[model samples]
Target chain A: MGGTAEAAGGAGAPARRRQARGQKRIEEILRAAAEVFGEQGYDATTTNAIAARAGISPGSLYQFFANKDDVARALAERYAARLATLRAELDTVARDGRDLDELVAAVLDPLVAFNLAHPGFKALFARTDMPAGLREAVAPVHAAIHGRVAELVGQLLPGRPADEVARVATVSIQLVRGMIPLITGAAGEREREVMTGELHVVVVSYLRRQTAGAGEPGRA
Target chain B: MGGTAEAAGGAGAPARRRQARGQKRIEEILRAAAEVFGEQGYDATTTNAIAARAGISPGSLYQFFANKDDVARALAERYAARLATLRAELDTVARDGRDLDELVAAVLDPLVAFNLAHPGFKALFARTDMPAGLREAVAPVHAAIHGRVAELVGQLLPGRPADEVARVATVSIQLVRGMIPLITGAAGEREREVMTGELHVVVVSYLRRQTAGAGEPGRA
Candidate 1:
């Protein structure tokens, strides 16, 4: 939610009605923002265009957002919230004590799906020129996701040294994150299918090497 | 060489001397372009800045490159030629009938070194907004490298189908290419070394799985 919407509460019944409407309008604005930002690069997207797409006046848009950069930061916050929800689900998967491939698939499947569903993800984060503040705002969430994965690897491989588990987790995350440009953005249907399946093989192989170092491994 | 430099050869001694200077100037300009492009980014870089880094007048720079885009395309071409030379070395490794790890080491070692030596390799090609012409000029070289790796995989696995070899090759390249940002840019020294070794394991394990299918297999 934007600042204005959050500020709209704490008065009478009529004031409460206005606050509800303001919050609804903010949701509409964020929806439209995703469309415009994803359809065009971030630099090409404009606040006026976002306002227009939301079917709200410029003043109404301004009531919620200071400008385009504000819109981007708000959107990033929205995305971060969604990722937090997914990570809760991922926690359950990590605790399931499954094989390495099963655990990885549980993590990557929803992640790639979430990325595809949210266009602003690739549009904002993939851009070389996305604002420094916006990147900073999102970095902690990204690191937290990596940290959780590292801890899961630690649990799954009890005898391994802590440092090696940390390294495995880092590169494992990198391997998946590295594929996003192809997976969510540029890849076509056939290429998508191939890369998605291959991503599992790549992730599992890397993980097994870590756990079974100098020893024979089990199934995928 | 720029159009003007090519034309200079049709004249006499002065023309030959000018052509030599023009070629030298082009190399100097390219080196400077790489530094600026890697240090900042493509859109932020200007021909004037590249010229200044090269310690040449703007007029001299323009005599070779028509504009900034022109300069990027030329650098991409130069990068392509270097890749061609590396592929020939890779071809020899494939023919030598070495172990899987040995062959993969021969290929990835030099490729990673090349990427580290030229930061512009990632800065230019990895960009979301790289010009279509520059990308097209580089695409063939990239495809050729993938092709050679596919063929090498085919020779290494005598009974593997060509298509399986091809698929493994595609993902292997993607895995390595995907890691380039972490490998050459963001990752620290310890992470870099860990990734470099882990990359070999990832490649070799994936390759082993492809050849052996669901069964246990020999080591890479």
Candidate 2:
């Protein structure tokens, strides 16, 4: 057994190097796919385009993904994971006892950054014609975000019913979701900044009205 | 010339009748297309299904539209015209001396009814993958609504700059647009009503904040 283990380790070292290379290629392909999808949208994009952008042969691209839908599904999974991380960070922020304005900024600023960094995420997620597998991959992340927002909402409006809290949270999330396209599609950086500020005002204002007189005395 | 006119009238009679029948068939096909598009979304819907739903043969359906895109474009034109009419009505409502609550209700209620009556409108309008021609057809109505809303914002905030008013109006319109799916996709009619009311609260709250100290002396 000792002799067999020693022999296997020599092969395992090269195998591990190959695995690392494969993983790096996969990441490169995904990053390239994201950019192409973000620029052209889902339907207009093709695997060839992604391969070209990634500087890989079509055969190499095919080795990693079956088709464009497969690539989109992988991208959706990537976005879901990133969103989960963001939500976890937001959970931490929510527990920090920030005021409502602080909370709004904490939540939205990271979200805007995430959206900017991952422009393809919205391109895929926002598609009405998205394949069911891709939608399934994205849906839970959305629900998790909604759940987290509802928890925060419940905290803010302590005496409110669960349903009302959930409703408000849903509306709040939708409001942010709706503004994303506008913010991302802004004509210039100045326009984007102004729209972002407007979003903060819209969200913070609605939340204040909803949570008015409901916050802890000191918090209010 | 007299004999030519009489001869033309005789041939034109059946041509006119055929034209009327063609128009009626087109409307039925459009009505059916709208329902199918709403139920199954654009990608899943096929011309055969639309023809079947409209109680026409595929051959008959082809007489009016070239393909699904053509059908969708026609439907878009129809929606654009209806939305224009709705906008004119909204313009009348804006001119009336209604308070903000009444104004919001006036705007949203009819819009909700329009969405309900034509579920396919939101289906097509909300799609990120919508075809360019269809999008162009819908874009003007959206812009007109935005323009009208911006005008109202300008009135409410009399001294505010055009850009700020435009931004507020864009956000306000987006807030309402964001809620349409939630309101329409609610689990039940009761939930729908609750979501609709919540939407009203959200829009009203945000607008009130934007317009709070800006309304005219008597208006405030």
Candidate 3:
């Protein structure tokens, strides 16, 4: 987020201020859209609902986006931006000498929580019916996340080829991607806890095997 | 699939014959629905297309199914039936006393392939847009699969609570559920191969840990 926000260098002051305001307004609309879309789901949520949630006039909403799909596209772009920042942060964490388990927890906690917190994401990407373009728009962000995770895994298990670590990273991410919903979708607190704990075992156990005879503590 | 298929004994002979024909027609229609749905996807697929694929008139199609959703429901039923067969076969494998890795390879290979082979499933369940009922219809089958997997895990790791094994099984299954798409949706064969191998690393690694010190060969 640091330096991610940049003002136009050559633009006149007024135009620059107006552009900043435009960007802020767009961000608000996307946030509101995410909330509404998450709660009511894509099919039930409407532009008016988003505008209402965003505390903007319908006209103001139109100034930024023409319809719900447009808002969704904008949201995907915002998610990508956030993901880029997350990746940068993750890169720094990997570079630091933090314990790999702690580093993984630091990175994955917020990452998966991002899904649980934003119902709109599950509604959009999880659903089979959202426009393919919306999922496609965000693919790069997912890929970027995967790439960063692979880098971190490679750093931890230094002896392994980058390629092997990458495959392991993809498996880990995909396993979590599949498991998160089942956890979130669990019938009760106990069930959610059980699933989460088991998932931790699944991931950690897999990693220990991959890093066995090589990296870090906690190996048998 | 034996006793599951039966003509009413009390009914007149002609009526019984008609019922059998009706059942056969339904199966054909569902198979055709799967092909069309797999190829074109859920939303893009039409009832007419399904009917044509099944080689029946619109009226004949309607006699069995009210609409596309009905076809999807029936397809889910068929999928469940197939899974039940799979579970039974897996149960035998579990009881037959084989190497755990070999057993796992035998079970998971076809199970994952089932998803890749059936594009209609990806079209239906994979879609963010599919109706809740559609997802719900298949939930029991998934649960059943989880239950069977857990049972097998418990058999391998005797003395552990069935519940814990079941939970681990759920994690493994969910992990596979999540990985298959990434594998099938992989950009190229090479990427897919890498992902598949890593997933093998993941599941086997986790299982080895779960059953560690309790069961199987090569335990050190």
Candidate 4:
């Protein structure tokens, strides 16, 4: 599907140049939109401010998006696509037969990489007012990654139910998400490494028990 | 510090009346501020809007707060105080004799209850721009609760390190905080029960792990 767009662009030089320019303009608009939304929030952010930041006119913005909401949806879609690529890349990095520590590291490293690479975009993606479709689209990818982590937990602790495994997986992911902004800021390098190491030990010890047959009783 | 304020107010009837009125006005301002801040956000929400919401002139708003930042700080302080009270209540209700599930419920239930009772306050509390002092005040209370939960986890799983247990406790608390807003409407009853029940299950299961041997290998 992406290949078709590239192929069509290659067929006509002038058309391709115009298309490339439009794409660049859209990217610029999205970048400006993310900053505005992050700083001022979704409802208060205006198309005019976004246009001013992008060094474009409102009419140019309208040519690409219907309005602010449309721009938000588009931005969210782009972010979700980026996250999907990261998820796939992380999956491709084989976890089989690795220690649980390494498997957990594999699951978390790509996410940290994404956060470091796109801190502003990460903040925007975490915003509450994100479009419903974007939330729906990202939910399954989250669930799939969580499922894989749960399977790893299951292997480490074969006595636990699949549900319990998944619950721990979800908690681990939520913690990392909470820590992203904190880790990125003035906590210092040593602080982040310590927090990460602490989190690792937490997961390992929690899992070791169910495999040992002394697991706490789970809620029905 | 609190005793000093109480002593000052206790010295005379006029002082007591003035203090009561001042506290009432502050509450009104906070209520108005929450609505404005939630609707318009921190950067865009105006002191005038907050004053108007409270049926007062902009000058009257300045009597209590120096500016919008002061107003935000006051709101955050009130919220942190409320959260502290809620944590205290949870600690009072929780008994060590209770099983892990009950213990978890006792720890989380009061927080959910407070949010259910004050939905607007919950929304305001969730806002990222909460004042630094308020955040700092909440941290020790959070740490206290986290430490208590960590001790419980250690009891349930005898061999886990205190540091590791504390990390899981922190993770669980963070999860509950993030999940509450997603699953509950600003103040709706139906969503409240659903969110609480969902949280109950997650906490119960996450604590009950599969691999429990001392210094067990990290491999799944």
Candidate 5:
């Protein structure tokens, strides 16, 4: 029995190595796709361009993605997963009794970092013509973010109607979404930081107005 | 010469009437297209659907428009002309010495009214997939609006750097653009008004903070 197990492990080693290589190749393709899509936008990007960017043959690209849309959908799923993780982290911050400015920073910093890290995420998800399947893949995550924002709003404005809380949350989300392109498109890190500060000011000012005299006694 | 002119006019009456009828038909088609586009969105809509919505035949629709993109371009042109007029009016309001809230209202109310009147305008222009020609048709007006806002921001923050003024202006426009969908999509006139009010608050608060010490001493 021990001899048979050893033989099986030896046989699986090459297969495991192949599987790891396949995973690495997929990540490389997606990284290349993100760069291309960010530069050329969704409509202008092509699988051939992505393959070239990936340093792979078009045939190799086809092994993983049927088309640019498939690449975009995969990217959307990746963004959604990352956003979900960020949301959980935000959930912790929201309940940590931080003041409005701290809370706003906690939320915006990671998001801006994520957008800066993945330059293609906004270009892919921001399009109104995003493929329906891709939108579906991202929609749940977006809804969750909205829900989480609303929950935070409710906490800050303790007695506000749910509808009002939701409305403020929706506007807040849109406000951040609207500013993201500006932040991400800033020419350099310094400019991006400035834009991010502006966003923080805009959001904090608005939330301060909305949550005034409503939350805990000492919360800003 | 007077008698000859009168005779020409008499003969040209039928031709003039035919031109007028054609103009009216074009207007009807555009109006229907706007409604249909607003209802069904840009991608889902077809020339055939526009024709049906206009109570005209497909052939008749094509007589005026080469395709749905042409119809959207025409609509974009129409919207541009209207926005140009609105911008001129806003120029008057911006210099009228209104307080921050009043100025915010002046800018937002008319723009909101224009959006409400033309439900299809946002639907058409908000799309990232908007046809290139259609975007070209509307691009000038959008730039003009941005410039106008920047000019206003410069006035409010007298000594701010040009870049800062432009940045504020860009963010302000995006802030309003972000809220328009919420305002337009509100369930009723009352709800829409509430959303509009909320938007006004957000913009005014942000501007108040930005222009805190740089503007005229007596200004808000």
Candidate 6:
């Protein structure tokens, strides 16, 4: 893998060594940034503290980041990219030619998986102190994720307008996203199951209605 | 009217008058706390900063609050009580035998109105860093809201299981709450309208399906 090769290069090689050192430093800074930002929060998190956590001098930190805001923005870009990757996986699921229930699960499962896999990233994104530039930068990826889900819903309901499908898609996504805290145990296990099971039923019922229409012949 | 006079009794009058004065200070502190926490954010805001914003001495602030955490918890309790009041209004609406659409509107309108009326409080509650005590305390209100909506949905479709009705209720509420940011201009007007119309259509269609099922001989 690229990551393994890059790590093996280390800082003693040559020209690539300099690049690797720079990249490694940035990674170290980002790890520290996430910890500090998660614990003390974004606005309270300082560049100096990030530097200290990374065991780097403030000047070295400044060489990579203009300020704390810069580091946060960089972190957001990385997070957006990661989300984009997960969104792509969701797109794959959407195209799996499954039934409506499977389709809905396809769209939601990756999100749940991503949140479980990298909770710190989710925590960082959840913080309200995120910079405007970072938010704006992240918008397109979020929009792309939404657009892909909407497109999948449209596929499942061939008769529905794209816009209409997008609407239902947005609402369905909203339903699951709202359950994040519960799904992740912030709301406790019993509450999580209650919410998740409820969401499952609602998604299925809503999708069935959208596809079957009101009082469609022979419909349950 | 009596509240105003009782609140005014907090003015420095005498030793006996200290009680009202202390109460007024706490109220002032809480108001200041909400505004600061809303505007500057929870973690970024400081107790001294809130005291200054309240136009009170730090000592006076301390007299009413042990720390910013205490003030925030108090403010959260106050906001939770306001939400409860709003829920009471929704309960009345649910009991009034209104049409399905009207019942849905009744539940949502008050919540929207409350957010508009107390943007500061809304912002504070929306923050992810809210104390665990505050989050746990609000869970019952959320459950009650879900339960009331479930009952109304059952009334609207007389034969659905109480659990199914509750699931639909939770989905609907989550749909609205999730889009609050979008509806309030965080996601732009066109997006808001499309989402609102889509959710309206979904709800209507789903309810129609349930009602139709009731008319079928030997069907759910």
True contacts kept of each: 0.31, 0.43, 0.47, 0.07, 0.43, 0.26
Docking class for candidate 4: incorrect
Candidate 2, residues B1-220: lDDT per residue as tens digits? 0001112234443322247777788889989989998888776688899999999999998776656666776787788777777767777778887788888888889888888889888767766445565676567556767787888777677888787788778788778777888888889997887788878878887888776763421111
Top candidate, metric DockQ: 3
For candidate 6, lDDT tens digit of each residue in A1-220?
Answer: 0112222345663434447788898888887887776566565567789899999988988766655556765676676677766666666766777676676666555666666665555455543333454465346545766786777677777787666677667666665555564466435656555555545555666677667664321112
| Stretches > 4 Å off in candidate 3 | A1-28, A40-61, A84-89, A125-130, A159-165, A188-191, A213-220, B1-24, B55-59, B124-130, B186-194, B213-220
> What are the models' TM-scores?
0.81, 0.81, 0.77, 0.61, 0.74, 0.66
lDDT of 4 by residue, A75-172 (tens): 66676677767655455554356665675677666666666666555444454433353455345545655676666556665666766566556545
Off by over 4 Å in 5: A1-74, A87-92, A95-97, A127-134, A214-220, B1-18, B43-73, B87-92, B127-134, B214-220
Candidate 1 Cα misplacement greater than 4 A, ranges: A1-22, A43-63, A66-69, A126-134, A159-161, A185-191, A214-220, B1-18, B57-60, B127-134, B157-163, B186-188, B214-220
Q: Model 5 misses residue A117 by how many Å?
A: 1.6
lDDT tens readout by residue for model 4, B1-220? 1111222235562433347776777778888887776565454567898899998888877766655655655565566676666655555555446666677777677767766555555444454323343355345445555676665556666666766666556656655665566454535665456446656665564564412343532233
- Model 4 TM-score, all chains together: 0.61
Model 4 segments more than 4 A misplaced: A1-19, A28-72, A87-106, A129-176, A194-220, B1-23, B34-49, B86-97, B127-172, B186-194, B201-220
What is candidate 5's lDDT per residue for B1-220, written digit by digit as tens? 0001112335453332236666777888889988987887775677888889889999987666655666776777777777778777777888888788777787788888998999888767665444465566567657867788898888788888897888889888878877787788789987887788888888988898887753421111
Better of 1 and 3 by DockQ: 3
Candidate 6 TM-score, true structure as reference: 0.66
TM-score of the B chain in model 6? 0.65
Which portions of model 2 show Cα errors greater than 4 Å? A1-18, A57-59, A66-70, A87-89, A127-129, A213-220, B1-18, B57-59, B66-69, B87-89, B213-220
Range of the 10 consecutive residues with the lowest summed lDDT in candidate 4 chain A: A1-10
Model 2 docking grade: acceptable
Clashing pairs in 2: none
Q: What is the lDDT of residue A50 in candidate 2?
A: 90
Q: Model 6 chain B: which ten-residue window has the lowest total lDDT?
A: B1-10
Question: Over the stretch B111-178, how does candidate 3's per-residue lDDT look in tens digits?
Answer: 76777777666665554334565566556555666677777778888887666667677677766766
